[model samples]
Target: MAERDEQSGAAPGALPRRAIALLRRLARRLRPRSVRARATLGASAVVALALGVASFGLLGLLENNLTRNAQADAERQAVLTAGLAAEGRLDTVLTPDRGIDFLQVVDAHGRVLAASPNLRGRPALSAARPSEPGTVRGTWNGRPVREEHRQRVVQVTVATGSGLVTVYAGTSLREADAADEFIRASLIFAVPLLVLTVALVTWRVTGWALRPVEAIRAEVAEISDRDLHRRVPVPGSQDEIARLAATMNTTLDRLEASVIRQRQFIADASHELRSPITVLRTQLEVAQAHPDPDLWGELVNGALEDTVRLQDLASDLLLLARLDTAQTPPSAAVDLTEVVREVARARKGDRVAVDTEIAPGVTVRGSALWLARIVTNLLDNAQRHADRSVLLALRVDEAHGTAVLEVRDDGPGIPPADRERVFERFTRLDDARSRDQGGSGLGLAIARDIATHLGGSLTVQDSERGAHLVARLPLDAT
Candidate 1:
């Protein structure tokens, strides 16, 4: 209330109002996105990331296992060849068709000792070099050669007393490279299929999640001023969307009540204006002839009073209309205490002894003109009903975050049955609250409208002794 809004000519307060507008825009554009884009995207990213990491891991394991199998095959054959050397049949055992391109035997020195049939005319096998087991890549003659990114091979020489024997056996890295290409191609094709399937599932799930929002929009669109009693469907789930729908329905309920009252106000106002016009017309008709000289002033005065009533009814209706269309001014701090005192003092001449009990700094958010009229109308009603005493109460409830104003009168309180009826525009009670007592009947209507426009409400509080009107305004503590 007191700390609301910035100072005049200063920057406007920023908050949920702006944030809500942005969300509304996003909701509009990503109607699909809202349905599940966010959730689906999150889920899909997790799955995709997991898939990539797993693919790399799985392939590394497969390559390791396959390369081990290839190396063991070469070692087993070399062992068979070593046994054949003892059988004096080494040349017969180390033959073709065992998945080896060639076989060779070498000594410790750089001297060729053996060659396979295919490489007999090619470079001869040299003595084993001192190196760790690993694959190496380079150009073999004029042709390019590639080795495994992982697999390795080496041949160590065993010392015989007179010479050295080399066991040159290990898997070919070139073959491993070819097998890896085939494995990689398989993953490249399979991952897309997996991703595509996941994406489709994501789209479906997102749409399912967003169905409640769609239903709410449809229900809201169907509910217009003519049918404000209509409520948006609430989802059974106690999730965020369900909460949103419930809140919107509550808002619609309030809006519907306000709109209904506005229409009632229009109808009541029509009758109020029509009644006065009829009176004025009758007066003019009676005065058409040579009017009685004594009754002339009284007749004119009566017509003048009717004219004034018409003016007040019209003015009140216009104010309600404006309130319905008016936008809230950027937040402004206002003192309810000052407004109550000013309105009470202005109406003091009517013999209305106002027992004011406003806390000094009681405040709220609203236009000065609108808030002043609320006080004026309440005070006017109190004056008519009060025999000698009317009470004005204004206070800020810090706990509730609101400011309250109450006006009560002891003079013949409104009947229990008609208490709610008095606040209606142009609905003057048969005897006590008749227009004959100077009620335009729009006071309560206008007051309530102003209260609503100020983001508050006006209602009749239950009173055992007299009529009690309560107005509550939500304070903007921006």
Candidate 2:
């Protein structure tokens, strides 16, 4: 019971502390959150700001007008008073109908002679602060006179005996002060209301702006590895964010395609792997059952041959994978004429006819390995079909600015219908003259990929010359 009481008293847990802190921050942001609050705050703030600037301007203007009016009144009255004091018309100047006050007269001795109404011969002019007539503030009658922000006017002139004469006048400013107070009150009241209105409006506008993003995020969240075909929603306009969403959807589409291709490739690889393993196993079983040494040797050779095919297929697969990220690293300024000569020199027996026309200094930019594969695949394909001889030709197409490699076999060529069909993996021509050389059939496809990757082309051209396979490579500046 003591332990439970202690846990509950005078101490807080970390979670409670954090929660309290969060709630405090939230409380600091508390307000009337609604459309009306936002509108009111926004409109009121704009009006208040405009009115504040206008109030300062107007107050200054009104004060200036008051000062100018007072100064003009003092100047006119000073002229009239000066003329009257010169004639010693003191009684007429102090007439009850006149609105002036605190009048005095002075002689050359600096002594007040006849003062009027509230003054009994007091000095009206101060020698210390003398100027042309202007508005000011001071005290009178033992009361706090000349309230702050109120206006007063003073006038002075020379009376008889060359001594100066002075007059003092003032009025209550209750009406003007009250008006200024009302303006301040209105501005103070409106400003906070306007601010609250603006915050509410901003929150609503932000929500509208983020709607498309929220939709895109929700759609993207639903996508899984199994359902990558789904795409993020695109907004109406081609804004930067919209384009970004579209790009993400495009990337999603490409990823989906890649996933599909990878699945198919896996299936294809499994089937290809199964064939060789089956052949090797069958050959080994036959060798084990029949104990004849010659038969065992033949069976072992068959198994070894199947193993070699498997190795070649696996190597090709690995090479293709590498090629995805591989630059043609072993590039050289290779002359196609020299390449043809080397291939022809390395060729065996009368399986192919050697025909060549080497352009003098034609060079191509490509890796030798890929370039060699391009040539070997065409020559081997030609050699397989050609009964009499295959013709090898090399030349430069000056018009096209391309280095051309041509291998023409006199055997039956690809028909116009099937010319595009032979490059696919494991594709065999349906034609009778086509040879079955136990090829994996990925050679042409790989060759085409390499050629294109090297900024060149591999093609079967319509040659009036013979059954044609031509490869064209670019001659970039060395």
Best by TM-score: 2
Q: Which ten residues in a row have the lowest lDDT in candidate 1?
A: 137-146
Candidate 1 lDDT for residue 27: 81
List the global CA lDDT of all models: 0.71, 0.66
User: Per-residue lDDT for 440 in model 1?
Assistant: 81
Give candidate 2 misplaced runs (Cα > 4 Å): 1-145, 148-184, 189-191, 237-242, 326-341, 348-350, 364-366, 385-412, 415-421, 431-438, 463-472
TM-score of each: 0.62, 0.65
Candidate 1, residue 203: Cα displacement in angstroms equals 6.4
Question: What shift in Å separates residue 6 of candidate 1 from its native position after superposition?
Answer: 67
Off by over 4 Å in 1: 1-57, 68-110, 114-152, 155-168, 172-259, 288-296, 329-341, 351-371, 391-406, 416-421, 448-464, 470-478
